[model samples]
Each structure stands twice: as C-alpha cells, then as structure tokens.
Target: MYQVSNGIGFYVLATYFLAAIESKFLRAIPYEIELIPQEEYRSKFCYSVAECRASYPRAMDRGNDFFKYLLSRVVVSSVGGIPKYNVDEDTVIRYMWDVHQAAVDVGKSQLSDVSFYSSETERDFFMDFLLAVEFSVATLYRPYINSTAEFLVGFPHRPLTDQDRNVLASDVTVREKAFMSSVKFFSRTNEATGGLFLTVWKIAMTSEAGRAAGRFLIKRLLLIPSL
Candidate 1:
C-alpha cells in the first residue's frame, strides 16, 4: 500500500484514490444536478451525475486531471523563493471534504469544517448532493419512471447488455478474479524495496502508460466492482 505524499508518491496514488472517491461520490449522491439561469448551466458546471454514471469506468477523468492541476498549484509555496509542494491538513480535508470526513479544525475553518477553498465550488458541490437527493426521492415515490423500462435500461449513457447482466449475476466470483488480476502488477514479492526496483518504478510512473495502467488497475481491483 503506497502513501500519498508531497512527492512523486502523490502522482502514484492520485489516480487510484481519486477514481475510488469519484465512484463513491456518484454512488452516494446518484442524481443529475440541475442548473438554473440557462446561462450558468451552459457554463462553469463541473460534473453531472448522469454523465459520470454513463461513463463509469473513466468517469470524471477530465475533472480529475484538472483537479490534479489545481491541487498541485494550490499546494505549492515558495520556500525561500523556491516553490515546494505542500498539502496541509486543512487543504487535504477540503479536497476530499465531500467524499470523507476528518478531525478538522472546526469553527476556525468554514464549509463543512474544511474551509471548502473558501466557498470555491464546495458550496455548489453540497448543493448538488441535496438536489440529487430531492431528484431521487421525487423519481421514486412519485412513480416517475415506473411507466418505462428505458429509465432502468441504461445507467447514464451506456445501455445495459446481457454481458453486464451476467457479470452482476456472478458478481462475487468475477470481481474476485478481476481484482486479483489487476493488482498483480503491484504484487511482486521478489522485487527489492530499494535500488533498481524503486528507480525503474519511478521512471515508469513518469510516462503516460505507467500512470494509465495504474489508474485502470485500481479502478478494477481495489474498488472491486463487478464490471
């Protein structure tokens, strides 16, 4: 298990951790957010639950990349004129505040005790969750989609196929195998902890292939989703 740090380790862990968080966030608040004043809706909208659900495997990838960009800049500070990477306790909380909770310095910081980057999208984020709740309740109790199977036919964009159904039917076994296969990349017991192993590993991560593989492995493995 690698750790997230103010170093290359951060990149190594970001893809996996962010994917997990994004998946859970959509699951927890699975509703399409609304936008008022058509103008605002057309611009500056971060992510829609429907879109993310439709593209579940690679969901929120663009946002996640931008999140990395914004976060990297935010965490950098000039230490005697040289910029250095840093992520204070408060900053960490703010990044994942909606996704999780921590022993935050309450009162001193606002927006769910994490400061929310000073109401920078964090406000809209909570609003999205609430809106999602209302939408879900309305759809269910009002018998909204009971009329058509189309509502349940698809999750976001992709229509369900027989293969997807089969996967769900044997979810436990399929997931177990998928998880084992994906993480096999990191299960090298023979490799030393230092020297060449560490060097090559870092080099690999510097390339797109290395990072992409990591992202895929984690989405399929640690998360243990049937699909």
Candidate 2:
C-alpha cells in the first residue's frame, strides 16, 4: 500500500516543481490575467529529453545520479526497532529540499569533492527532479506505472510491465542508474521514450489550465488516494 502520509508530501513537491517550471517560461493564455504558467493546459509529467541525446556524456547523467542518491537518503529513520513512522509532509519536504540544496551548495561554493552532488555538478549537468514522479509511482497504488503510465489524454504513453523494483534494489545497474536502469535496460520500453514522452509534459506546461490539470492530477492520481 502507498504510504497514506506521503500523499501530501508528494503534493508539495508536485506544486513546487510545477511552479518552478512555470517560472522558467511565460505564455499568454486566453482571457487570463497575469501570465500564469500555462496557457493551454495539457499537464503531464514525463518531461526532459535527457534520454534522447544518449551520445552526450553528461546529458542526464547528473539527474540519474541525483535520483540514485536521493532514493535512500530521503527516509525517516526507525527508532527502537519499531516500524518506521510515516514521514510527515513537513519533514519530507524540508529534508528533500535541504538535501537538494546541499548538493547544489557545493557547486555554489566551488568545493572540490567527489560526492554525487559536487562531482556530478562539477560542470553544468542535468537534474530532472521529474524523475521524482517515477519514485512516487514506484511507491504508488500502481507500482507498475512505468509500464502503464496513462496520460491526461493520450493513449498510455509507455505501458510497460516493470515488476522488478525489488530485485533491482540490490542490483548494481539500478542502484547506479536509478529510473534509467529500471526502464531502459529491460523489457521493450527503452530510453527512446524520453524523446516522445517529453512532448506530453510540454503540452501540459503551456497554459494555466494545463498546469492546474497537472496539479489536479497530482492530487487525484497520487495525493488523494494515499491521503
């Protein structure tokens, strides 16, 4: 079962990422005041063409690195051998942001370290927090979403039956490569999906309604059920 508690936590994250995306670009919408994030709302999550240009050495390498580092680090510790408590929304949000910043901070200070954050960020590299969607789905009601991600309107963009999260957890491939290792190396859904699926996200991030629809998706598809 999905953690009832992480629903709100994911919502906060979804909201932040959506807002961040909006802040990056502005588009005029029909009958809307103040350039809101999207003008033609078709909000989807599978953005980033990192998987497209596989020839680029660092195209998405950092994003994968960040995701790998974050998966285990973003956890609530169990105390006294009791079952681990559900991570509260504030804690999850704060800890994740803090960790993200910590990784980025070393770059701002120009520190020389081999930590994933510092080393990966050594040059301008990609960091697709969008992969957080994969993480969220990995723990969602439908844990096999990588194979069956139904979009807001299109046919299931990348319906794949990925049932090896447990096995992959202990494998070097997934541990080192995160979502990429999970989808790209096995089954038929290869990294090429990154090329087309990103179109879905662009449509979603184009208008206010589009953005709202996406956030609404976060609430309904992910947040509400778990909550």
In lDDT terms, which candidate is top?
Answer: 1
- lDDT by residue (1-227, candidate 2, tens digit) is 01211222333343334333333322243332222222232121112232112322232333333334444353457668744434444334434444334323322232222232222321111222223343223222132355234321211122222333234223333223333332232212223575445455545545556655654554343322221
**In model 2, which range of ten residues has the least summed lDDT?**
151-160
TM-score each candidate: 0.21, 0.23
Q: Clashes per prediction? A: 0, 12
lDDT of 1 at 73: 56
Cα-based RMSD of the predictions, in order? Answer: 20.8, 19.6
Query: Cα lDDT for residue 176, model 2?
Result: 33
Tens-digit lDDT track for model 1 on 1-227?
Answer: 01101111222233334444554522464553432323532321223434333433232353354346444554356778755556554344234332211111111122232232223233322323322222222212122355223222222122223344234334335544443333333333213343354355445545456745644543343444534
